[model samples]
Target: MSQPVYRYYAGASRTSRSRSAAWSALRWSGSLAVALYLSWLALFPYPSLSGAAADWLGGPIHRALGFAAYIIPLVLISALWRTFKEGRAAGGVIMAAASLASLISGAGVLAVSTHPFGVSPASWGGMLGSWLGEGLATALGGFGAFIACAAVFLLTLQVVLGLRLSVAAAWIAAVAADDFQKWRRSRQELATRMAGAPKGDDAVKDAAPAPAPAPEPVNVIAEKAPSGKGKRQPSRDGGPMPAASKRPGKYALPPLDLLKAPSGAGNTGKPQESEIKSAILALEQTFEDFKIEARVTGYAPGPVITRYEVTPAPGVKVSAFTALEKDIARALKAKGIRIIAPIPGKDAVGIEIPNARPALVVLREVLEGPALPPDAPLLSFAVGLSASGEPLSADLQKMPHLLVAGATNSGKSVFIHSLILSILYRARPDEVKFLLIDPKRLELTFYEGIPHLFDPIVPAEKVTVVTNPKEAASSLSNLVKIMESRYQRFQLYGVRNIDGYNKEADKR
Candidate 1:
């Protein structure tokens, strides 16, 4: 009967409870310390916490924190692997946490590499990049190594931000192309409206004299009024007639015969029908190979480029094709490809390929085409044809300025000559003036004896070019003075623009 001998284990119970409480408190304190330390690092990497904390923790500790931060990605990966093994939902949560950690670490690395923040490479982000360089530099070259590391870091940031580089690039290209086309259309429409409108001087010259109305009989009493008796009653209806307008006699415009007709203009001997069909078939096959559902709806052959319009199957992103532009071009045996994903307003995307046999754009062809109307502005001159094979002309009165530039043997001189010739065909010498600047005298010297010159062409001083520094400077100064005088005149007239001023003068 030993039932009365059983004793309570209270001492053991108290000791176990006390141990648990101490461990819990220690854990909480450790967490709080870590959080506060992180806050301090963020607020001031080199904290001045009354200078005591800084004295206690020296440079080695600071560097250690940086290195530890840089290795966060590795730690996160290990944690993610454990969580995934434990539970699926917990794995997803760990993935999200890891992504955030990677993003922050990657961003820090990028910042240090790009700009000299005076931070040591021992710091978190910088350390990662430095390690990457040590591994990649010998194999990939210094620049390539740096770029490879940058791309890795940037990829992490992009992933977290839910951005795909290919998608973004395609979208930007599409939008830019659409905006450009809209601008061109609006400009062409404006030119059409202006071309059809009558000029003030032209209207006056074209007006016909009105036939005289049947004369009304004057009263005999009024006609026979006594001399000096009463002042003759003035006619209420009729006023003084305007002064008879004088017309400029027949001055001949420059002949269009000066320009040569476009030769071999059409697609005469370019890629044959068989070749085109083969190319189209190849493109379709490539799409099929890539598992992209698309149909080549049609093809348009142009002077320098051939455009193929492709309609992607529903639910297929246009960016898919855009991303495969190089592959498609290679398949088609072409030099390059320009993919306009979802060519604005159309359901189809456009893939422009360079023509196998490109056609030359003849200035004469543009000048002779429908680009110029019978009553086009005096300044209107053809530059080239549009993609639709229509000539494109520009108005100098609208432009008010032009700058021609090209490398040697690039047809800059020929283009300028064509422009000047176009002007001569439309305007009289007095209507427009030219001030040729020939620092490289060879290009503009041929235009010397033309009547449109504002200043007489002077012989070159030394090298058959305006090589004298002082003379060139003086000529430029003179141009500035001329420009200032014109500005002053524009201001004096109370007109906002040259066009408005010209129209006002025409009314008078």
Candidate 2:
């Protein structure tokens, strides 16, 4: 049976994606163009386009651009107004100011005595500012009216932006009063000190103290270590002396290379360049068959999957291609396909197809590749390899807990062993402890006595495994008690969790 499926990237719906794109385009193109045109009008009241192309195309382009100028301000005002209504005070103030200017100028208050920009005032900006300026000049006589209107605009800006001027005014008045009082008091103190000054020679003699002798410097030298024979100490077992002791240091991490290497470990036959090209062609063909417009932009081959990135044409919903997963899979002669519509933080959709020859990510290979940060917590472990073959690791401390469940023979036991081994390679025994509970005794029998255990503190073959249901329940009950104890300690210290508790304990 053919299956058609579509998974929305990061749970974002189509409407949200469209809105985000629209807002971004409008903010960048619309707002910027308007701002620039307005600036040009203010700077050069009369400017001309001079060139052959200008002579041919400039007239029509100029008219179109003039329409754009009016449209840009209107769009900006609408956007700003919407943002302000959404509880953004700054947007409100910006919208109010822009509207005021546009209104006054557009009302025909400022008639262009001369075309400053070599274009008619019928274009877009400067209408409001000119009109407001003319009305103020007629009423209050230029400068007086300009100053009054400026103050009114400033007040309007403050009110629209939700700034309380009363608080600011009061604060300024209080600061001035305090400063005046302090200055007066300081002047009085200065007058008093001048009146009480002693005669010059007597004051100087009294103020000066007798000169003292300088102390002698002491010689210092670095301490020399006791001389020893340049011979290695014999090991306690009477073998040739070991280079380093096996005993764990106070802050020592478990060494790397403790995990086993993969067997038959030659390179897995990943898809060839020809296979990739065919796959891309297959995708394009499938889309064409479905009457959908899409082009495969790129692909990243991962351990078990290859992700093909697809960029759709304008006005095409990514969801359309996503819904054709099964059809595309059939066309490519693949078992199945999965589609990610409009991948997060990217302007493209992703189609993930399973690799023909999947590569296995070995635990040791990841650890040996790069040194983990020295301060990484004991709980950090390699999860797997990412799509681009980068080692992916995760911190169990951040997770705090985990639950692994799967069908029989699903490599669950191997995964658990890898987790335990990863922890053993990083954490010292004193730093972390593990409580292993196994109802199906076969799985955890291998990890019976690895130093990091709590119940089976001393290693013994028969004592560690919990085979019965009752035994497993008892172990779990004890774990609950331990969890409660930890909670009490966390509460006492006013900390949030184990991480917080550990940080506080470390500080002490």
Candidate 3:
């Protein structure tokens, strides 16, 4: 029973294979028929002798003569050529060369046939030879014309068919692209669903949670055993451990003297905001004692501090002020304090204080602020919170250009977004434009519909997508042309940059 089943399955497989082959052959036949029909329309002027003769032969005679005589031999020759060249696949090249040669030969024959010239022999031998030569030439010329006309007809047919094919192919490609996009969206949705599903313990373990805190150590001490009669173990918690007898490789905490004083001065035995204020005032007094003028910049909840922007009196060396950083830190009763003496490009010093309650400055507020003048030279950037926890804004006109570097998740994107939002709020669409190139496809896609956008959100033409170094070089060549044209315009107008040109235009 199994043998019979196996045989039946094998037979079915064979049958299916044969059917597939037959279908492929049918499709090819149809395509060939179409190609030939088109070729015939273009090359109809060229006649086939065999086809002509058969048509002229009497109806009964033609039926007896059969069309197979002309068709069968040509079909056999084509099949044989295809089979022989199947491995190398040079048939297309051969066909193209043959077509070209036929066209040239046809043109030559047409020219010769249209020319009016007759040759007369002077002697008997010459006349006989001339007659034979003339007959041969006429035959060759007729054959050439026939081939040329056929080639032209076929070529014209190919061009028409190719155009139709191209249009059809474009439509198919568009449909396929749409389908692919839909598939991609579906896949993303599926992935998101899977990610949202409850995970197992293994998945939790893979996430690797934060390490557990270490246990605290106890101090122990030992004393010399009674004259070394026998060594005795000391109690674990008796007295202060000798420095040498302490646990190996353990670090000793720093002395309490290094700790900073609480922001307030004169313990009122009751914590009050006045005490915190007094503490800051006391800190400022200390700065005065050092002969350094300091101002209180920020104060908050605990670890209260103040910022001082100071300038040493004239004739005081900046280095002399910086040298007091360690002494200032010690005097302030603070563990850590930074001093920026004679800040870069300025004669003022910057001292920062940690605040008790740092104020939060939302980015939205800055973006909603008043716009800068059209002629304003400065570009502003939001640097993070100062020591006092106040949001800081730096004028870019002073820096000109900034180079920002940070590790991942360092708020780089947020900073950039803030800058863009600020600019958008301050400048009109005509006054500013952005050239955004985000290959990842997400960053600037939101701004695609904005009128200020120059090129399409995504390049529409393949030629514009520079895929190679050579293409980039070609692009640079075009850019050079644009630059040269701009320069010429500048020269003609006797202006400098875009600003000068715009100013002159306004005057005109």
Off by over 4 Å in 3: 1-306, 309-337, 343-348, 367-399, 406-411, 428-430, 439-449, 456-488
- lDDT tens readout by residue for model 1, 317-408: 97899899999989988888899888889999998888787777776566555565445676677777554445688887777557777898
Residue-level error in angstroms, candidate 2, position 242: 20
- Give a tens-digit lDDT track for model 2, residues 284-363: 99889888888999999776778899999999987798679889889888899888887899999999888788777787
Models 1 onward score TM values of 0.45, 0.47, 0.33
Q: Which is the winner by TM-score between candidate 1 and candidate 3?
A: 1
Estimate every model's Cα lDDT from 0 to 1: 0.61, 0.61, 0.47
Look at candidate 1 and give me any clashing residue pairs: none
Model 1 ranges with Cα > 4 A deviation: 1-251, 264-272, 342-344, 397-415, 456-470
lDDT value, residue 334 of candidate 3: 57
Report the lDDT tens digits of candidate 3 across residue range 334-374.
Answer: 56666776557866776654444433444532321222222
**lDDT (0-100) at residue 383 of candidate 3?**
50
Q: Model 2 Cα displacement at 484 (Å)?
A: 1.2
